[model samples]
Each structure stands twice: as structure tokens, then as C-alpha cells.
Target: MRGEELQELTLEELQHLERTLDVGLSRVIERKEQQIMERLNGLEQKGMQLLETNKKLREKVEELAEKQAVTDHPENVFNEDAHSSESGSLDCDDTSDTSLKLG
Candidate 1:
């Protein structure tokens, strides 16, 4: 077929060769499409898994942030109205105010 002795082949032989080539080409295209579909499915599954993992990580991060906020500000841990005496005694310390004034 590559410019090699094409004149020797009769018209019938050329037609047969063309049919064979067409069948082979069709099979090749089918196989290529199958592989592409498999790859696409794999990538889609991986993307879903990553999205789930990201969601879980985001939840964990929010949990940690909430814990950290509570830890950083301890006032939320207690209700002053319920423990008025304890809060009043704690207020006597006033250690949170660390300012110096000279007049």
C-alpha cells in the first residue's frame, strides 16, 4: 500500500484489502473509546473521593477552630448569672487589666 507494487494487484484484491483495513480501523477506534471511558470513570471516582475527604477535613477544621476559640476565651465556659458569687469574687482580682497610669 506504500507505493510498493500496487500495479500488480487487481481491482478485486484492492477491494479486499480495503475491506480488511476498514474492519481493523473500526476495532482500533472501539478499543480507543473503551480505554478513554475507563480513564474517565476512574478520574470521576477519584474526584468524588477527594471531595468527600475535603468535606471531612473541613468539618474537622471547624471543630478544632471552635475548640480553639473556647480555649482562647474562657468566659464562654461559665454563666455569670448562675454563679454570681463566684463571678463577683473573680471580679475583685481584675488581673486582666494590665495598664499603668501616672498623674
Candidate 2:
């Protein structure tokens, strides 16, 4: 009933209206909690997406840093003849026998 109708009613009728109002208020509170839960779930999904993005970015940064390190290395100053040999030994092949002969 309308407020003016309820104002004309007995005290018991007003109390019954107040009870229904309280129940409706509780329903509104429950609906708000559901809305909040859904929003929180969405936020968690976004947080996971952000974490994945962060991981990929870190990997890209590491790749860039490695590329930078390689570029920063000093240029090879040694002659081609020096580096072409299969042996990592700095001396000429003849020098191996020379050392043996001296010994």
C-alpha cells in the first residue's frame, strides 16, 4: 500500500510493512555482495594477464641486454692468418717442433 494508505492503517499493519522493508533491504545487500564478487574475479583475471605481460617483457629485456653485450665487445684485431688455424694455440705450427727440438 502507499505511504498515505499505511498512515491510515492500524499499528500492526505499519509493523508488517516495516518487516517487508527490512527483508527488501537485506535482498539489496545480497545483490551488492554478488556484484562485488564478480568485479573481484575480473580484477584477478586482469592481474594474471599483467603478470604474463611482465614475464614476456622481462624476457625481451634480457634478449636486448645480451645483444647489447655482444655488440659492445671489442672488434677482432688479430690477422686472418692467426685466426684461421684449427689449433687455438697462438704460435705457428712450426713452433711446436721448435720447442720440442730445444727441449
Candidate 3:
């Protein structure tokens, strides 16, 4: 079948050999296609899993940010009010000190 001693093969024998080779080639091609499809399916599943994980992580980050904002908002307001009151008292003290110095 490798072109060696092919002169000895009759037309019928060559035809049979050709048919056998064609059947073997078809099986090989079919198996290869099946394996490719399986690999593609595996990769697709992995991609979907990664997407789900990413979505969960994004949601967790957003939740944490919201919690942080809620917790920080009150502190910010408290600090501002505290600073304003302190500054107001300081201003009163400064005015009294200035009046005493002038007198």
C-alpha cells in the first residue's frame, strides 16, 4: 500500500484497499471531531464558572463600599460639627483676650 510491490496488486485488490483506507480515515476524523467538541465544552464551562466568580466578587466589593460609606458618613458629620463648635469657642476666647489687651 506504500507503493512498494504495487505491480502485483490487481485492480480489485487496490479497490478494496482504497475502501478500507477511506473507512479508517473517516473513523479517525470523527473521533478527532468528538474530542475537539469535548474540549470546547470543557473550556466553555470553565469560562462560565469564572464569570460567576467575578460577578460575586464585584457584588461583594460594592457591598463593602456601601457599608464603609454608611459607617463613615456619621463620623464625617460629627467631626465637622465638633470642629465648628471648637472654633466658635476659640473665637470667643480670642475676642476676650484682645479686649483685655486693649484696655
Best by TM-score: 1
- Candidate lDDT scores, in order, read 0.83, 0.78, 0.78
Question: For residues 27-74, what per-residue lDDT tens digits would candidate 3 score against the true structure?
Answer: 999999999999999999999999999999999999999889778655
Backbone clash numbers for all candidates listed: 0, 0, 0
Against the true structure, what is each candidate's TM-score?
A: 0.71, 0.61, 0.63
Order of the predicted models by TM-score, top scorer first: 1, 3, 2
Better model by TM-score, 1 or 3?
1
For model 1 the local lDDT of residue 11 reads: 95
Worst 10-residue lDDT window for candidate 2 reads: 94-103
Q: What does candidate 2's lDDT look like per residue over 17-50, in tens digits?
A: 9899889889999999999999999999999999
**Candidate 1: tens digits of C-alpha lDDT, residues 1-103:** 4547878889999999889888988999999999999999999999999999999999999999999979976755756575677445544445656665456
Model 2 misplaced stretches (Cα beyond 4 Å): 1-7, 74-103
